[model samples]
Target: MPTKSGSQRKRTALLLLLALTGCALRVPVRQLRLPDKLPPEELGALRAIYLVLRLADAETASPDKLSRAVALAAEIRRALEGPSSRVVAYQITASDEPADYFIEQSSATGVLWLNLPATEPDPPPQEVDASTATASARPVEASLKAPYHFYAEPGHRLILKDSVSAAHKSTSTAENQRALARLLAANLAKDLAVHPMTLHRVVEEGGEPELKEAYQAAKEQRWPAAVTLWKKVSTALSDDWTPLYNLGVAQEKEGRFDLAQEYYAMALERENSKSRPRKSTLRRLRNILATLNRLAPSSLEPAKGGAAHIPAWLRQKMAVLPMSNETVDIEAPQVVRAKLHQALASRGYRVLPLQEVDEKLKEIGLTDGGQLKAYSTQEIAKALDAELLFYSRLMDFRVIPLGIYYERVVQAHFTLTAAASRTLHGTRSTAQGAADTGDVVLDWEEKVQYQSVSEPKKWAEALAWQILERQVSKILKVQLKEETEILVLKCVNKLPAYFNP
Candidate 1:
């Protein structure tokens, strides 16, 4: 009996040893892994949402948090484009507008509502003396209704959010018009992603809730399915960041590091600083960004010429002026001007030193560029002695419903012009008129029981600015050459590295 017991004990010890060895074989990851390039498939999906963000007067935002929000959006856009997604319009300024096709989004303290109970019509007033010509009115009686509230839960809604409409005007640019055209195509893409119009397509016909299935798939690490579902969510609902954020989290979990980062950047961009991710999440994000920076080519620099790949001929005879964006939204004008300046600088223009530029323009008797609709670029060019003209203006605006989760929207229109007539070149096209940048808009709203009651309009505008920055980055410098050179310099300098592989 003693020998048998000893044998059993030995076998138990051997089993414990095997278990320990198995445990030792598993590795612990101190940091999250991130990929260098945006996954092509994921880019394709993001490009499906043709989001047109409008520009705004950013002056009020200087003391406020708006400036950072705009920058964040721009960074996110750049990040998306790194993976090659054109979902966000190229560039942004304060005076841009949204295209007609893309739906707008906004939120309300978004409460419940009920009409007041009917009351008996007020009794006819007693006739006054002829001289008085006035009458005393009788009051009507009716039971007061209870305070009606829009009983909403604490979740986000993809569709069925509130959206308010605004009017549009005639003045717009070719770039603005192009942005409009692009938006329509993108909106269609969103619809296709949602209902899919086909059996094999990933988007479910029902709506936002349908994505719950995809969310589940992502949690299970099924990327392809999750990608499709997230696309549907993005397209079906215009500006709800909840799903996008979740999708990004799931994508990373599934080992789709590139795609995951894109989503997370966008999600974070959409969220206000107050709503930013926790430190742990940021740490994970930084780890991922560091990894991608290590992997990506470092040559991403601002473009030096027109939209075409060919660099513009450096004409000793110069011609350029500052651009102006005249948007109707109630944002401050100074912010718009500064953003435009930064955007131009990013495009690699040899701009006047900001202080000098301001003084020089003031000396020329042009206090506000937005006021002079026509000859805007010409006036600035002639005054600043900028032989090359850079002009921009704003136009139409509209607000509409977002079906994914019904939301209100705000929009703007704009154009950008770069002419070289000041040097009096024999060029016939005459670099005078502003080119259209297309419709710029921002949107947000809710239709879920689990969402907050914060007004979506502010959020909508916030999104518009965020996406606008990305648009600026894409529009200004589209040069696709290897970014290795600049990247190496940045890395060697011990500065922040570009998020690479």
Candidate 2:
């Protein structure tokens, strides 16, 4: 008979194989849905509204003034009817089909109010028969008119809360009134829109032909083709979240969980906070997170959804990437990286050596100096066995000419990302320093001070050559180094607050 330990080992191997097979067979399906419950401010995009232009008859105003105001109101009505407006339809006439919401504004003062018309008004009570009336019958309450015009008819609810500013500083009264009329009309059109919760479906419907093709490929489970199209879409709509979300879905379906999770996290970052996440998005996020937590607990540990302070352990194995160079010279990034490395290493931080980092990257099949843009910081950190990643970009570098002195200025942006949770913390630093130009004229006075020699001109010439031959280069380097050091220090000082919590 086999020993107990041998039997246990065999059973464990079998279970592992079964789990791997299950993961391989699983097909993820995500459903995208729009939210139904929306805040009032965002509900304006889904309703039909119209404007009521009430010109306050002022006896002091001339007939021409009234005509001009009417013309301006017509102009505003046209402006409000553009294709971009969410309003179903708008008109200056009250004879149109009853609008769900009405925006009434005074052409004189530019005051505005939104009104909801009563579907049915209570009919006035018929005069009671004197013989049937009891002595204690409720005395008829005399109706008194409201102090200010209610704007809407009886029983209609009017909200007189919105006050708009349409003031113009024109010398001519007519011009000012025209400008106010335009401004008031635009404001009223925007205010009467609905304020209800809403949801949207993430449909891969229309765009470029290539995008549609990509969507079709994804539906057929052809992942690589889908990924290509989605990536193109992402580049085209760099500021939009749709492509990023779609890419995440594709990666998840293909079993590239790590990449999928990163893409989803990025999609969330790109998403607008005002818009609620689709049901499909929320479901997919939860599925990915749960799967990652089960398969690789370490990778899921840093999903803090916020900028949590950097932990002490993460600071042990840190990597600083080459800063992005925005200037003409390509060597600036490397130079700055080397200086920043020295600065960090000197501060007792065990900064990863550039050679060792490159070797690790090669092991992961990334050759050359592939910075964060080429690959994600999380991917690079995992390859280098780094818990913390430092990224810096040189935003500006310029030398301002000042006659005898050149002012060197450097501005840099820095970000620290935690590899485990994908939290980002960033800061910007700037430094300015001056270097003296080695122009011959700059030292003309010093040369004149010692002018008593047989070969005074020759001596002066020799002296100037000795002092100024490489003086400009030397001065620039010193000044630049000083500026770089100051910038680095500022970044370092800010790190504690950003990472510490």
Using TM-score as the measure, the top candidate is 2
lDDT string, candidate 1, 346-411, tens digits: 444445555666677777665454533444455655566654333433221112222222222221
Instruction: List candidate 1 stretches off by more than 4 Å.
Output: 1-24, 27-59, 74-347, 352-417, 420-501
Candidate 1: Cα lDDT at 463: 56
lDDT (10s digit) by residue, model 2, range 1-501: 856698899999999988856433234443221211222333223222233332233222233543453454464444434322222212222122222111211111111222212111222244556797743322222211111111222223343443433444443444555665576555544443211222222334346777778777766768688788888888887666667777766665555657867887777666544266566655655655554433312211111112232324334587776566666545555767788787777755668997787688777676534334557555676678886566666765554433233345666666555455321123222111101111110000000011122254465565554445336645565435655666665444323211111
Error of 1 at 497 (Å): 18
The best candidate in terms of lDDT? 2
Q: lDDT value for candidate 2?
A: 0.45
Residue-level error in angstroms, candidate 2, position 311: 5.6
Q: After superposition, how far is residue 400 of candidate 1 from its true place, in Å?
A: 42
